[model samples]
Target chain A: MTDALLRIEGVSKRFGGVIASDNISLEIRPGELHAVIGPNGAGKTTLIGQLMGEIGPDSGKVVFEGNDITVLPTWQRGQLGLARSFQITSLFLNFTALDNVALAVQARSGHSFHFWRDARRLPELRVPARDALARVGLAGREDVVVSNMSHGEHRQIEIAMALAMQPRMLLLDEPMAGMGPEESARLVETLRELKQELTILLIEHDMEAVFALADRISVLVYGRVIASGAPEHIRSNAEVRRAYLGDGKKKAAGGHG
Target chain B: MKTIFTVRNVLVFGLLAFLAVIPAYADVTGNTFIMTLFTRIVILAIAAVSLNLIMSYGGMVSFGHAAYLGIGGYAVGILAFEGINSGFVQWPVAMIACGLFALVTGALSLRTRGVYFIMITLAFAQMIYYVGVSLDRYGADDGLTIYKRSNFGSLINLSNKTTFYYVCLVTLFATMYLVWRLVNSRFGMVIQGARSNDRRMRAIGIPTFRYRLVCFVIAGMMCGLAGILLANQADFVSPATMHWTRSGDLIVMAVLGGMGSVIGPVVGAVALLVLEETLPHIIAVVGHFVTGLEMTAAREYWQLVLGPMLLLVVLYARGGIDGLLRGGRRD
Candidate 1:
């Protein structure tokens, strides 16, 4: 729809004989959390890559705020307020948590051609970076080097980096991929608060978090979106249950309450 | 700032003071050869520092860095041969030439990664080396000699060995200061981020390639300045100046010194060159004492000792000498 903040229209991608994305069309509305649920090898990550401009779609248009940005470079897309967190936890391991988030803030400030001023000493970058870290419950851990931090804490830093950019929408690929239950719960709580202000497209295997936080759920199977609608509609959709959510029904039900 | 009195700072200050007084010490001892050797060390240290900018921070391992040294040297040599000897004109020409070479080669070479990048850079340097060989008018492989040093009007005397040594020392410190400022700046953040993860850097709204190319050009220009000093120091230029082995030596200097910090490469250049100067005599004495071998024969096998030492440093001291001094602390 024209009101949709991000719209993917019939995007398809092929890798040799494998179809990574097969006519995948979806929409993310403003201030809404959209969760895409899929089985392993369902090309969920490929979808995120296409939207983030890392992978080219064979046939389709990606419209953001009614602008066709299908072929824009990844950084230009990011400049247009589209941000992403890696599924495999990519971070500047040598840098401190505050330094990592400040880099994200620096990316959005302008062209970083500054060659003399110490970037780490800037209050403008540090203040927002601190606020984002505190929002993710990592207030006191800012000075910890990322390589030394726990895996769950790295995920939180990932989110803090995305938030520091003040992005219009976030494409998060498995933000809770390696997190424990306690960390998952903490992240779910953070997302609940964030959903009030930001648009998010979440690709997660955790059904409980998906059912609890998603305003609308889309079920993808083998690069195809089988169903997309309200959470209740997706839960009852027979095809979605048969293709992807069969074993997750109990967890989804528990989360809904 | 309170950590300024740390062991590393003290050692660094001690080294700087030692360098500053080398000419005075030579004057007292009448051992002018020491001044000449130290001047070469200081000039090459600037090149090593430039290499560290791309290798350590930008994660670009160029194997053809010596090509810039040759380019800068040849810029002076060729101009001096043509009867143009002004430092102002010759120096800028050398820097611009090196920058242009870097831009063209970097555009093609950066398209590949890992060993491919290394090989491409090596190939380009070899190509330049061959071009140097083909310049028969400039003495080709026999090399070209500059009859006079670059003329700076009333500025300073390059003919004075002591004055030239001071100039090289000043330039090394300035290069280190510039690199320190660059790596801490906003531009440096983007460069380091790209080095850590190029994909993530692009996703985070940094047009990484352009920034990296610019970095490559800056490093080339800096190394070119070192080349100018080296040509002036020796008053000669040859194709061998940018030989692949020379490139390898620059890489060794960076690795040996500690690429993580600005001063590490300077330490590395001094250490490697000084070891090269003294290791043969040390080997001869040790060999004569241990196994009763003839001193000259033992000196011939000096590399046998140096090889294992380098291996030990690579294996045990992964961060090089600078890392060893820091005791595993991050720079």
Candidate 2:
């Protein structure tokens, strides 16, 4: 059997009597594009937060690379090869795109306590940042300030920042949430290219993109995983049809949904 | 044309050149007091720069910075009063006191943010001020006087006015350079990221609180060094040195200079101190011409005009003197 990159077993979370994740168990293998989908407030974001060590599961364990990391802090998990992007675009709007990515590269390198040389002037920090930006199709835009970028481009930079960390598996939350059809199509193509090289655990609402890109799909509702399978199996599963796609027209959308 | 004169770059190089040359000209003219005055400017600028590190970059506004200054000054003064005049003994005690205070205060204050954080820091500084007032041997509320400067021997004679001025200048430049490097370092990036969006930084696997707290302590320790030099410069230490209002003055300096860049606070310190020195003179001269008013009376009410001037700076010159001189170039 292939080594599982991420294994979540019986993980549950509660906030003041509200269940965010209810004993959700799932495994993501290396180099696979796994997608998580749910209706609004289905605990998708909370589950991603628990995976990145932003929130601890009330019960159950999160094992990554065969090591239990349920208690690790965020940065430690980051160092151990887990990287995530925000559902909301969060960036240093005051800084140039190059500066933002350069900072992430700096984090993975040695100690940043060196006080004399200007990091901007250092070629080591800039080279990898340049490479990361190029990978995200933002090569010439590195000098542009983040505030000046369009909403779609800002989203792209967010992913570029995560890519700069060079993680084993990428957790992307709502990567195409706010975009025009053209922008969404472009991001879909980019993810299609990236999936060949890196394992990705994506949470998105665009059913077309989710079905087009996800190697496997997991359906979440009211904080529990209701079904998990390949696109064909999930599409044919009867309960998934009733619980998630029971809205008659969406059910007609068939495997596309 | 705008590309050639970005507000951030123009102000940075321009200020460095001016600081380097001011003392050189003053020295040639034998107006040595200008050197002393500038030295005072440089030392406090160091503290202002430290405040900017946490405030502008880390997104933490602390009103208790002057407490570290007073703690550092008292460390030197109390040690001196007890016949321990060595720089070695005095400097480390000042740093340790500031660090200890910062660690405790940061632990409590970091739990709160925004206006609550501001008020809590102010309250802690006030507590320190009161403790300074109760030190009877160090002159209590009246203050402690240092009979001699720190003994660094042949390494640098701080007793000589020019030498001391150079020392302050070097330290100020060093601190500015250090802060510039810090804001661009990996740790600094995490701090800035936290400042920009703490929720996002945490989502992306960056633990933010520990970085912020460390930034807080580093800022406090830096201000402590400023306090040591301040006591040495004035040859005195007192409760008044650490008053919460004094912390207000440091904040004003950082804001007035422009908090976006490392060198802005230094420019603010020079502008403020120079104005403090020359405003009374201008007021006295104008008063003498207008109403034949006595110089002493004109001097006493100098603050009347000073308050309005600062208000104007805050109103019209939102970027402060650096911004004004650079023609409103904002980063």
Candidate 3:
């Protein structure tokens, strides 16, 4: 726990009598790819929302880099080296891929009160924007408007925008939410590479990617962590199988090469 | 991206050329009424440009925008009424009053979104309008006549028609230039991003409310400056200046011109005002020609034509005049 890069300690939330997060606790080690998997309404998105400061927990602490950031605003959390992408593809649809990434790049640089020079012309902002896009395999599509891009491409651009923030860690909420298998496979590869460089707390349902990429996996059901362990142990856990994996454990084990 | 020879660019340059030579054209044709009409359009165009900053670019549809214009014009009028007739003092007062109004309204109103925001702004504008009507010393609903224009003294004279017209025209151009610079800057990007997806903006670590508030205040100040110019242009100030309908007119101009482009609202202002000025004459001429009778009443129905033209623009020309010229390509 002392060495954990991010920790959620007994966080609980209720929405009009519905228990969304019930005494949830977890720790993500630095440089480890931690996956939180759950069925629909398992409060996976709620967990990510709490981490990103978009949702206020009814109780408990969210400690990032050993700082209690439970009440911090979302942007302040970003300033604290935490970043997140949306589950439903939230992006500046009117802006180009580069423009979207560049804005994320600008947000972390300094005060954006600059009202004179053409922002697109600034190399200082655009250079890092390009690098982030390139890192996410979106280099050639930088100038394309986000609305014109494919769903997969939008997913990639979302990751690029998060990367542009240059945060110490990323809270990715279903980066593979709507992707096709091909796009999902590409994203898995991208995530595989990114896990080596930056600490990632991923909430996803893509079983193959989760087993292949997650150094540690937590199973959540009805807003509570039922089990947490490494992929191999989680795969064999009798409780996890009964609760989540069901018949899919055999496929997840044999399905991936 | 706006390549020099695009149809939109040509039309913009043509409009600029026409505006620049209106005084000269009026001189050659011995038709000074055109100058008077265009000067009004030019000044109102400044107001429309300010609205566009938050409307088209920032995605903040302020239905109460006319309140600033009223505040600005009243600042000039009240100051002049008190014998403080200096242009320097009156203009700054107008801007400050408008800025303060925007700060308060924006702080409260920006907390809500969509129709609620629109309704709150409208409510504020109406409150100011009735306040204007209730000011018995300022002539209330009957309005007030400015006995003296803003005195610039040695710098320039506002009473000279040609000079005032040029002044309005120059100010319009400067406002356009400023908006052009602002919409392309880093600050502009945040405003646009917020408009596109505000949640995404906050999730990416931007305190969107502050940026939105600043834009609202800047827009208010700009409209306030236009109000000062408008008061000087008319030598009058009235409560009707801030009426909700006037705010609607600004919105119409923004949508009619193209909300996404900087010059779209200016184009809309020119088109709507010019049509308002000339349609009566056109209707009178056409009615007499076609009916072979004195059909003088048709001129009164000019807005009948305007309603449909706006409808057509809204339906088919979603980008407004600028977007139409750009063949409906939007950023």
Candidate 4:
């Protein structure tokens, strides 16, 4: 019970001459919504990419469920119950909203080689897919093609996909980007509900949502974490203000909260 | 409800009916040319359908699909030369050879993307084509002739044109049905998602490459079956069966029909071959009537018309003939 669901121990990633994730260490306990926020180029996405097994860290290791998963490929990491949503609204556009989530549910289910019957009619797949869509407020839009949906809706579908996996840990990158206030509010509610069930590491630029949802906040700057503390402490910290909050132009240029 | 005909459903039903009726028509007409032409179309359609599994659904544009055709054809050719003419033996050998080739090629080619993937697959197929050309014992560049069609041991007399046509038709329908099941399955969903956005799939814990490789193998195996049928139809096999240009022809059949829909390739096969058969006659008539031009010269220039037709399809009819038939609808 005490073991962290995901632990990044001195994990660092370098892209060419640039350091994307500087020897950073973080631990996420169960049922915690830890938000990693930073200006642009902060390596928050890269760090998540490393943890999700999409990108390998140049040095150090990532341990998930007491297993060193630094060398594991992205799909293998998924099999171990680590799920992530993209910063970009990446989804299967041709699929109906339900079908997109159904695939995630399929990944977690038994082998997908069951070729004879239609997967869409199967209760095992469709039931979980419908539940996931309902969780993300897309119950009515399950039949809608994802490409025809709005950007905000696509983001929700992405979240629904991650949720459908029934993952032990969730890594979400900028889940609220490109959303209107109403959509953001809805997503916040969905995240709040999800936080109670799954361990979440959220990277978001929406300050209000970040402060509202994250139990702990880690501020990343130029591929390094300059500050990590309680959200209240981060909100009032002078160094954070000087380096990030105080510079409106810099923050705007660097991107979101 | 008007039953809301989708391009997919229409193509599927249309192909099935056409395949079902072809043998009966051949039985009545006694024109074996129609059966032979349809057999060629159906065999190629199998290749196109198999390719659709990866190219359209998986978003992998492999220019080397013809390589499987070569492998399958050569398998039958070499085996028949060695005094083995069993359809059962030749078909499995063809399938295994293509599957193995596809596995190795897919593994290497999957490491790349976009045009690079296309080029790598083409290169691998070309390698096989040249290898076939070098096998002097099996006729090499000259080609090998099989004296007899595959021996099915009295259950089906493939020597009978109608029987062979039905066999090709049945195989085509089976291949189409299998692909349809595959695309709608959970595995199919992953492959399609991987095609649409691979980065997103990987982010969601789906390892897309391995799934794609498996898909590549399945497609190759299907194409290999088409190759065996093709050898039976022609009673010969050669490097020309697997030439890179022939691969391009398969792509044309796929694109000309529509890439995504299961039966689009069949429609393309039927349309392309029908045009090839009739266009020369029509052109010769026009040439002789309009300007007193020789029929022989016009026949040799049929490709000029086909070249422009493909260009038009690429430019204006991006969805292919199926799109036109469905009135601008897409699958």
> lDDT (CA) for every model shown?
0.92, 0.85, 0.90, 0.85
Q: Which candidate is the best by DockQ?
A: 1
Per-residue lDDT for B191-216 in model 2, tens only? 88888877656545566787788889
| Candidate 4 positional error at B67, Å | 1.9
- Cα deviation of A33, candidate 1, in Å: 0.9
Give the range of the ten consecutive residues with the poorest summed lDDT in model 4 chain B: B1-10
Return the interface RMSD of the candidates, in order shown, one decimal each. 0.6, 2.5, 0.7, 1.4
lDDT of 2 by residue, A36-133 (tens): 98777779989988988878899999999999999998887887888888787888887899988887777677555554466787788899999988
Overall local distance difference test of candidate 2:
0.85
In candidate 1 chain B, what residue range of length 10 has the lowest lDDT sum? B293-302
- Estimate how well candidate 4 is docked, as a DockQ score: 0.69
Candidate 3 per-residue C-alpha lDDT over A115-166 given as tens digits, one digit per residue, 9 for 90 to 100: 9999999999999999999988987999998889998899898899898998
- Runs of candidate 4 exceeding 4 Å displacement: A252-257, B2-19, B23-30, B288-296
Scored against the true structure, residue B217 in model 2 reaches a CA lDDT of 90
Candidate 2's iRMSD: 2.5
- Prediction RMSDs, each to the true structure: 2.5, 3.7, 2.6, 2.3
Task: State residue A161's C-alpha deviation in candidate 3, in Å.
Answer: 0.8
True contacts kept of 4: 0.72
**If you score just chain A, what TM-score does every candidate get?**
0.96, 0.94, 0.95, 0.95
Clashing pairs in 1: none
Chain B alone, candidate 3, TM-score of 0.97
Task: For all candidates, state DockQ relative to the true structure.
Answer: 0.85, 0.39, 0.83, 0.69
